[model samples]
Target: MTSQYKSPRPLLGAALYASILDSLKAWLKSDGLAWLFAFKAALAAILAVGISMRLELPQPKTAMVTVFIVMRPQTGLVLARGFYRLCGTMVGVTVAMTLIAQFGQYSDVFIALTAIWIAICTAGAARNRNSRSYGFVLAGYTAALVGVPALQDPNAAFMIASTRVAELTLGIVCAGVVSALVFPLHASDEIETTLRAQSSSFFSYIAKTLPSRKAVEDVVAMHEHLITSLVNFESLRVVAVLETHGMRSRSQRMKRLTSELMAASTRFHILLHFRNQLRLSGDHQTLDTVNRCVGAIGRLLARSPDVLDTYASATGTAQRLDRLRLRVQRHLAYVAKQDGFTPVSSLNLATASDLINRFGTELSAYVHTYASLQDERHSRENWLEALTPKTDPFVALAAGARAAAATLTLGFFWIATAWPSGSTALAQGAAICALASTATNPFRLAIQIAGGTLIGGVVGTILVFGVYPHLDGFPLLALAIAVATMPGAFIMTRPKVAGFGIGYCVFMPALAGPDNPQSYLPEAFMNDAVALVIAMVVAAAAQALVMPATSLWFRHRITARLKAEIATAYGAPLRGLRAEFENGVRDLMAQQLMLPRHEGLPIRIPMAWLNSVLEIGTAIIDFREAAADITSRAGLSHLGPAQAAIRAVLPLFKKNTGELRSVAIDALRDSMLAARLAADDATLLPSERSRYRDLLTALNRIKHALRDPQNALGQTGQPSVAAPSSR
Candidate 1:
């Protein structure tokens, strides 16, 4: 009877355990990030509050609030933000002390200096694009917080600054630890997924484009998708740098891979752009050579398994492609000597051959870097590490101006009111202006934050007075804090209400002002709450009223810049031509965020316009690089006419009509013929002839691109769609 009872109990327990484990697995698959993020955030908040209380800091809530601010879904992002926050806080506190010390006797002078400093920091924050921007935002707002508090008790400024910094540091440390120790979501994991997706998309694009030309419309669509993939890769790589040790070690190689991928894509497009020209020449030999080469590359691309598993597998495929490249070069050399060859036909064939070879080389480099990622020991030598582009000066100036205007408006309001809560309002407005300045919709975000603040205040009040009073021990208090913070943390994990969540977490602890004794003053709560709401409203209003960067205006600026860059491209030096061309167009594509596809408006530039700019710019840069090289080598004697013709045609690209461009193309063609005849001199070296031939091809392609802007732009007479417009 005892054996029978024990057996049944074990069986029943096993069944129950199996069911619970299954349910947990399903839950983790669906809602892991949200759950883990919330848990980590709550845990961090609890830790921060406990540490602050144990240390006997004046503002325990400040430390708790910081945990909420710095916490992110991924370890890399959290660490990055935390690092920047510490730096920004230090800089801000130092600035506040300096200003206070210098202008102690003159309140007006101190206030004025603080406002100016806030504006500058706000400007810097608004201008940058990544987590680095957070430093500037913190610097600006921390100054206001530090300076405004000290106005009441000037002698205690040092103590106030030191305490604030310590509290923030504790908070950052707690958030980082909790996030890392919990179900840690690493950015490197996301990066691997991105790399696989990117590689897959690239292969798909290559398969579709090679061997033959697709419709211009289809090709254009592929290019847009490719550009998006590349941009995503870049963003993921940036975060991946800080994600894991492995990622950090491979970061430079990944960058080089990105550059190679871009160069390869550019070359592939060039081949497609001129493929038709080569076929239309009706030279069966040249056409066959081109077809054979594409087929060879396509077959080699097919040999690789879809997934990049290991270095050995990728190397085998790369070796096969290398052999195919040699065969294609031989075929091109053989075909160039045929009797039916015209200068245009020969140049087209040669350039297409060169591009195919280049595409293979770059692809192999990218594949090697990608496959080697499984193990760092397999990592190879770097070839092309692209330089990061500088931010556009005009964009920086616009952002800075807007930030300054908003900050000054709030600063002036505080000075005029002289209200007791005026400092709170001033500091809040300046902080919001600095942080949210780069947001897509600054006013909307600010308003949401205000709503969050009100909600958080209520929650914080309940926890501090009602819940905490019932909890006597550290464990109970920690539990109480976690319970209070859970709702905000849950909301923070949601994408739509994230801004509201930020406001809630930041304002709750701040308004609650948890301390050892826990001061319960309803008047202070009401005053601060009103001041916070007023500050947000004023900040939102300032952003709305001050030279706001509406989508419509931004699109207009991008359109102008695209036009302006062609002129710049024409005159720019050749050393970094390819990088500048690629970087500039990609930057423009990034700015043209969300253009409606079906909407057609004559006044606005369509997404196609930017796409056209990319293609056209690529062709133009190719022409310029080839022209510059030929001129340098041949001493501008044989290639002078062609070089001059290129210069003459450059200005025609700026024209609205195609008539002048048509004339320019004729002039360019005549110059190409002259250069080709000179290139045929038997005394000239084979390398010189090769350079001349390449230059001819570049010129010829540009002429064709100019002749039919519609074809070049991949537009089929559709009216342009509206670009970014006011929502």
Candidate 2:
């Protein structure tokens, strides 16, 4: 009664305050990191520019530009990038000085050498990924920045080089320190969280998709997420290794964990493929058996502890999963023989059973790796081996060729015209080629960057002439810098338009060329702006003219490469081959995802082809693993005829001829019959007989899979489905 009579004003105010605080916290939880990153970036730029002004360095904006370029969310990323930037800057300076010394008087020769160096660096950038690629990019552009500016005054080359290095170093230091000390994020933290989330999401995906007839879009989306997670994890591991000594020590475990995840995912895909194949063959019994194994695995994962939870729970879950895996394997073996006759269906069941068994085995290994990451015991053992990254030589060569052609064209144009702004064209062309090499959609990226550059140039020009005349001292300069950069920093937060910020950052400082006594002439601004725009235009045209990438030809090239990888998979060695194969196909999948949508091009067809390749390749790897011990114990001669037959058939699958594929299928079936006859040999040991039987079963399943004309191995021609297109 007394409480009811009390005034509600204080209570209402407190409740309102609590609600506001909660809402604000939620918003911060969602968007806080982005805002914090932007704030730190802007602040670093302001401080760098202000310090450069105080020190009276030439082009204080150079330091500001570095701040924008070096800004990353994680402290480790910032430090890693800064280290590479420092290294790249020194190398570029040396290159520029050497080039200037060799061809000081011949501008054309100097420009060509500079262009070639840029092309080489761009090629390196294309071959690399993540922050590693950033180093190559910086190396390319820094050479242009150092060399082009000093072309008019050769004597000032050292001074220009030294000043640029100093400015960039200052900016790097500022960005690294600010990013670390202010609300610092760690790559390790991100990786740990992702590892858990990915683990959970993967199991959840398997569980959810298994019981239902999921749409193709949903399946594609699910697989896309898994592939991206795998790729992202690999990149994060590299960055995490450089973050701290502890992380470096754990790098091997981390690498092992990634490998296990990939292997597990590969097995999962095998299981899914077998299930799909069974359905395609209209084998209801085998499909039912596949579903049962998948269901059992899902149930086990469903009951497991949160992978990101406390160490005790994770270890317990991992232990339980290990025990469950043995049970699952035994169950699969029992089911494999439950059905009689129907060689095709029985073979499908056997393959599915083997896939499930391997999946559980790999899943257990993955769980162990996960548990190892949470281990407190740090060992001195060096296990930091990494898988060799897969690269396409043709892709790298094409990129280099395009860059070289672009740079040479621009160099020739500059020489032919004898324009005063030739240096601008050379510098921008090299920089653009270097930067654009990494872009998935270069055509679209070029347009966005160009548009953003023009906008940024205009804005920067207005700010320099219209506002700076009335201002003085470091404070006013800092304010102006903030005003110019904050909007871009904010724009960088948006994923769709983040590239706009890059263009803005690059052009703003170039157009303004912020110096001790700022140039305020409209004519100077307009001339620089016009030169910058023209340079971008030349670069874009060069890119278009030299190996244009958006045509059907490029799509076909990607498709052909993907098909070739299947043949490569068939012949790969077992040791370290699985990881490499998975990574390669995933890389191709990523490239496939990047293809721009066109009217005639349906991504689904390539996607379906990709899925088929992955299935066939994965099955081949499984066959190798399964056959290795058996072939050795049972003697190669016992399996020789079958192996030779399968080998002969494999080449036929690589071609687009349906008749050849049919012949290959027939050959495989005959080989399977031979294998089954050998499996019944009375001289064979029981264990050998079992292995032979399993081998024969897998071969039969592969033969049955090949019977479907549409599932031909490495075949390019596929019936296209005209679904709503997606990228």
Best by lDDT: 2
Question: What TM-score fits each model?
Answer: 0.87, 0.90
Stretches of candidate 1 above 4 Å error?
Answer: 1-30, 104-108, 211-213, 276-296, 299-307, 332-344, 374-386, 389-391, 464-466, 567-571, 594-613, 619-635, 711-727
- Superposed Cα deviation of residue 14, candidate 2 (Å): 4.4
What lDDT score goes with residue 613 in model 2? Answer: 65
In model 2, pairs of residues that clash are none
Q: How many residue pairs clash in each candidate at the backbone level?
A: 0, 0
User: Candidate 2, which segments miss by more than 4 Å at Cα?
Assistant: 5-15, 211-219, 280-282, 303-311, 332-348, 376-385, 388-391, 409-413, 416-418, 598-601, 630-634, 708-727
**Least accurate stretch of 10 residues (summed lDDT) in model 1?**
594-603
Using TM-score as the measure, the top candidate is 2
